[model samples]
Target: MIPLARRAAIGAVLVGSIAAGVLPAGAAQARPLTPATDREVTFTVDGTVTYGTLHLPVHRRGQRMPAVLLLPGSGSTDRNGDQPPALTPHTLAKLADALARDGVASLRFDKYGSGRTGLGAYADKPETIDYPAFVRQADAAYRLLARQPEVDRRAVRLIGHSEGALTALMVAVAAEPRTAGVGLLQPLAERFLDVLARQLHEQLAAAVAAGQMSPEEQRAIGRAVDRAVADLRAHRPIDTSAMPAALAALFQGLGGPSRRYVESIDAVDPASVARRLPPRTPALLTCGTIDPQVPCDTTTPLATALARAHTAGPGRVVLPGVGHDLTDPADPDVLAPAALDALHRFMRCGAPAAR
Candidate 1:
């Protein structure tokens, strides 16, 4: 196995059903694009069969095609890069289709807590889910891609978004020789808790600036965040009862399987991990100015670390006027042109040196 390593859909939800609270319930569901061939596939991990979609180029011209294993972000998100209870645009699906057009095949699977895999993959034990287990899953997916008849084993790649990007980095650190490259889009780059604290503070500050929140409230939230992060670091249960609803939700999301899970990932310094990657491994590090969750300030260190390690490609692929969702700032309805271009280039060639 090349080592690396969703929510069950109710019947036929509209593809647009992914938009979190934005689209009207009556909005039309998106139909699958006809260009690339998509096949439903599965692989076993820890004895549980995992589900995924394999996208292939419409017409393969005699040559073995490159392959990529796509990992979705956090939450109850499915293989399509969607989390129910909110309709998100099909981010991973779009990326996979785009790659198919470029003659690349990709496999995107539902994660443990979401989609078909469900939390059962955790054996009904949420505490079993942590950083290393996630890394192992990605490694398993990489091996699956390698065994594909249409794939070039040596050219298999990884593409991860949000938390998935962090997982991708860990996988890269111990990647097999055949593992080709990695694409990290909007990844958590700093120590996990530190990044979480930064995001919480920024959001609170923004709310205060917008007059939606009081200065006093922001301070209270900040203090709570700091305390919780500190407690998590100490392996203590976080007290969220006094926190604002927003702060409470944030903490609960990050502190999965209890405080220990938070501690496990928080101890991981993403930059430090990047430093351990084989120097010759090519990487595409992307940061969007408007990505509230992974602000440039937080992720820049990881990008710098990659540069320091001489990760192949143009050091940092800066996405100006882009959002955490990969949408264009000017037109939130469309994917950022720069993002699409960068992805196409990266998928085509593991490394495209800086201009």
Candidate 2:
């Protein structure tokens, strides 16, 4: 029989959906060509099962290269961060291409329950969806790359986008031999509930001020947010059925992932998580200035979180105009300019000095 510790380690790899509201593309930039050879890889984490693509660079004569294992964000998205542009599709393939230009290889896997992957639609509990276990899979991928004659074993990194970014941080800290670094996208600096409340407050208040939701509807939404936050903080199972009838419907839609997560994650401060993270590895905390979801304010907290943790060898970078994905200097994928510059410098600076 597998020891419980071994079983937990084996089970730790397992890992969302969303009612998203993103603006349609008007001024969006067209995607550029990203060089990669797509290959499939199965990812089994926790009790859930999934699959993703290994985006390998086509150019390799004899030299080995470093690689990144990308953890994607939520919802019905695919390995390339492919989704309707309105939702801030990460354009992950685009990013992969960007990295390819830098001689870095990447692997992007489908989230649970999508593509050729299994439907991990149901989980026993949020804690059961272990983030650290995925690190093992990440370690496996690193080993896979290292075994490749074209991969530089010492240079592998983990680049997670958006919510995926947090998972990357978790994985980096848990790396068996430790990871070189991470590329974090939009992640929570505040507690999950606080960020949710603030985003809703901003949007709803604007709408109420502009008379989008009727005062009655607005009041109902307000009550719903308050009740949800309160129940989450108290660890009380949300009475979705008893929620204001209109909002009750919304509550149910948050079933499975969001409901389970909000319940377990309300008290988790991402900054606090960072502060307590094991100091075994270094990291690169990057965020965008105009990120629609995380925003500049939240990114500040993230940077503060890493700093407060005294992320000594690690560093933080905030992009301007870029949104969550750091794709644009606009709203959602806001990546910091200095952060991008910093990453290039760091990656190069860490190259062998004796060689």
Candidate 3:
């Protein structure tokens, strides 16, 4: 299992009446490309120059085309779903390629600490970066996508992976002109801290089973984590002085530059957010059986929430052998065909239903 600290760092819905099913092996082929152009774009958010790429289908002219705003997942991930110096899955970029081929436009940007949009005004005071700041950036991106002359404002959709999924939900719930739908890919079905706590517990348990940590040591760390979680949730300062070295380092990192951001995200209940989605809001929830970060079983609450809300689209799809990045486990460099198929179907069928 990946370490707690490392795993902690990395962390959409859509429309229509498509049925959920798994694509057969080798079914990852895409339709022939429509000529498209990629342009570098920039937008301002809270005085920061946010950088992004806008993908437009060239063949479709004189008609507004469907569009999507791709939100990157947690930790230093960039506009193209890559974390430099190591990870380079290119999930979002591939999705943009697929969407353009399908005659759909897309916009993906570098958020705060990543890519060309690095830090910006927050260079001196990184602590000022919080969940709301990310939301504002995404909202700005969505607005830019909607305003583009080539996009149909009413046909714009939001697709986010992992932590970005929460941001997408918040934006979709409050979007003006009413967002057409959302695609929540590899989403968190619970509060941020709750998910963190559960992950820590599982890690600790595994450590004990492996004999790397004694049962007593595991219990001690678990207790410390519980206290720290309570402090974060209550908006109180975390006192990590008494924690084990590993636990202390983890909590200190969370409580330092990103404390406010961590707390803000912790306070959000994803299920509750799902409940607030506008009536008939189309949603597509997906999880991968091979995704260790957000295992398929943990998605129940989010699926349940969407069900109660009466949202449209193919509900909660569980993909086989796919990972959190929506790539096949064996080939992390390429996007999974089944995942792509789901997204294409959603975008194709997500036109706003007649009132």
Candidate 4:
């Protein structure tokens, strides 16, 4: 599931110190360090105009460059991998620049409810939007990227972060033009609700042990959460009357306008999706050891699935002391060099001989 502002709220309720930090101005709004030409592009999906920034490498005469479709994580994250005012890592934008330096083109887009896309046709009916809606939007973007005259249609890849990684798997599984490769960074590895449940249980348990929440209260909240999950999976209404205020609000967020999306994503086990990838697909999976949202261990099953399917590339590269954004925790401005290096190697674009 996409990280949302509500996650901080829930964290505060369950664990007071789990607050999100705001990046300094320099880090939040820094221009791309590497030079690349950027084109603002738009495509229609479900009558919604999707806005994106296509970063193209300097043209080499008679050369059709490899390309990638960059997918941002969940929540209100924009095409640049920023959830404005609080989180502004600009992960995808920097990634595009990196790809440009490697003689590869990349397209990063704003999905519905994000950036310039802003709900569009679903402005008043956001509830109608679900997981498939995002998949459709991404599929359209992939098709658009592949059709670019300067792009090598056969060399187009998909690279996604967090929730976007799961979307990439789904899109690659059914790509029409066929995907050259896939890169998953801090991916969602389990069923969405299962991960949510485990997180809530751990936090609630810790709160009880810390004397922040009573054991009785923890039991009550757990029951309420279980009930809500059941209702969501069964396609019934969630009843939050028995839940505490904070828990109630969180469930309401999960079950209201985003309910359909929650249910749809929850139905998918990412490892299962990985198993369906076409045999021998080039794939790269990476996880940060200190990433609280997606623990490295949780990605083991996904890595195993990909390996069993005979997918190629470095199966899983574990970066120590890195956070969910693939950055050093102490310095959010710079993405971890190891992560970037792994990506560069996977794309196989930076070498002069390759160009």
Choose the strongest candidate by lDDT.
4
| Tens-digit per-residue lDDT, 45-68, candidate 4 | 899999998888876554567899
The digit string of per-residue lDDT tens for model 2 on 147-245 reads 555556566677777666666666666564356666666665566668777877677778889977777776677777877777766757666643456
All models: lDDT?
0.76, 0.60, 0.84, 0.86
Instruction: Name the lDDT value of residue 157 in candidate 1.
Output: 85
Estimate the TM-score for candidate 1: 0.82
Top TM-score prediction, candidate number = 3
Clashes by residue pair, model 4: none
Ranked by TM-score from best down, the candidates are 3, 4, 1, 2
- RMSD for all candidates, in order, please: 13.0, 12.9, 11.4, 14.9
Model 3 per-residue lDDT tens digits across residues 1-355: 1123543434211221121235554332332334678889999989999999999876534457888999998889999988987988898998888888777889999999999999998989999888889999999999999888878787889999998898999998888657888889998777888888999999999989999989998888888899999998787889786677887898889988999789888889888898888878888888998888899888898988888888888778888888888986667666788897788667756585311
- TM-scores of all candidate predictions against the true structure: 0.82, 0.72, 0.87, 0.86
Against the true structure, candidate 2 reaches a TM-score of: 0.72
- Give me the displacement of residue 1 in model 2, in angstroms: 23
Candidate 3 colliding pairs: 11-74, 12-183, 12-184, 12-185, 13-182, 13-183, 13-184, 14-182, 14-284
In angstroms, the error of model 2 at 309 is 3.5
Candidate 4: where is the Cα deviation over 4 Å? 1-35, 349-355
Mark the regions of model 3 whose C-alpha exceeds 4 Å error after superposition.
1-34, 352-355
- Report the lDDT tens digits of candidate 1 across residue range 244-318: 886788777666664555677777888888888777677887888877787777777888888888778755687
Candidate 1: give its CA RMSD in angstroms.
13.0
